[model samples]
Target: MSADTQMLSEFVFIYTPLPTKEAAEEMAEALVAGRLAVCVNIYPGVTSVYEWKGAVQKEAEVVAFIKTTRKLAPDAIAAARLRHPYEVPAFLVLPIESGNEDYVAWARGQAKA
Candidate 1:
């Protein structure tokens, strides 16, 4: 199916944090280059605390908000895994049931499904 005509099942927003902006962009670029994701927005200065090895740790990370079609979720996640620094990265996908139709269309259109 043509990428445009390809029906985007729904929207999914994937998120993961990086230690640095460069690293964050690297993951984004890789996904976009491979057509796994359409866009990724990086936000700095996020504090994260989680349990690791039965201990609580805190760190500052650059959060990457990835926008992509549902069909590309697996590829997008795989791309992130390849670029993520942490052995266990915080990758979460949130389905977008409702959003601006036009904007969603543009987002889906931007991706080469």
Candidate 2:
């Protein structure tokens, strides 16, 4: 990729799951309010199956996709963890490898490290 492409790729989408829609909304608002994320999209009615404490667990969850710049990712994660109710909240930071340049620029501008 060219330098320009790299510059445009300096963003990430953080995936975080919460037990309820309310929790997801709260986290989303907190991140946006704190300027850690440009926007957060919340999706409810997700069924998650995983292992915890040597037992399998299944539960419904709401997922949040947080959009922000790479520079603000760490801060966003920290803020999410502080407010997340889960003992070990699941956080997956997916790099924005490519996208509309305008959206990338706008998201980066909205996020503050």
Candidate 3:
């Protein structure tokens, strides 16, 4: 892997769906305050379609994009599980391969391993 890739491998984007914008905002605030995430961007008005309890369901939800280091991912996930209302909340983590150097550095600095 390249230097940038290696550097970014330590970073991740965690996507979590909440029942409401208020829930998303609350979780985001907690994650950031606890230093579990460098940043959390809440996107409201998201439509989610999935299978649950052996049935397909569609609902309006809010998605939170949580940015953090891989080292802190577990804590971030744990926090989400505790705060999320759904019995089976969506907690997906995506590896960040590369990004702007300044932003990456800032993120790394903000989210210490």
- Pick the TM-score winner: 3
In model 1, the Cα lDDT at residue 78 comes to: 85
lDDT of each: 0.83, 0.87, 0.88
- In the range 1-113, model 1's lDDT, one tens digit per residue, is 54333433467889888899999999999998888888899999998898889999998889999988887888889879988998888889887666666877787678875
Which of the two, 1 or 3, has more TM-score? 3
Off by over 4 Å in 2: 1-4, 7-9
lDDT (0-100) at residue 102 of candidate 1?
82
True-structure lDDT of candidate 2: 0.87
**Which candidate has the top score in lDDT?**
3
Model 2: residue 70 alpha-carbon error in angstroms: 1.1
Instruction: Summarize candidate 2's per-residue lDDT along 52-107 as a digit string, tens digits.
Output: 99999999999999988888888999999998999999889998777777876687
Candidate 3 C-alpha error for residue 101, in Å:
1.1
In candidate 2, which residue pairs get closer than 3 Å at backbone N, Cα or C atoms, i.e. clash? none
Q: What's the CA error at residue 43 for candidate 3, in Å?
A: 1.1
Clashing pairs in 3: none
Q: Candidate 1 or 2, higher lDDT? A: 2
Q: 1-113 in candidate 3: lDDT tens per residue? A: 78677766688999988999889988988998888999999998899898888999999998999999988998899988899998988789998887888887788778855
Per-candidate TM equals 0.85, 0.90, 0.91
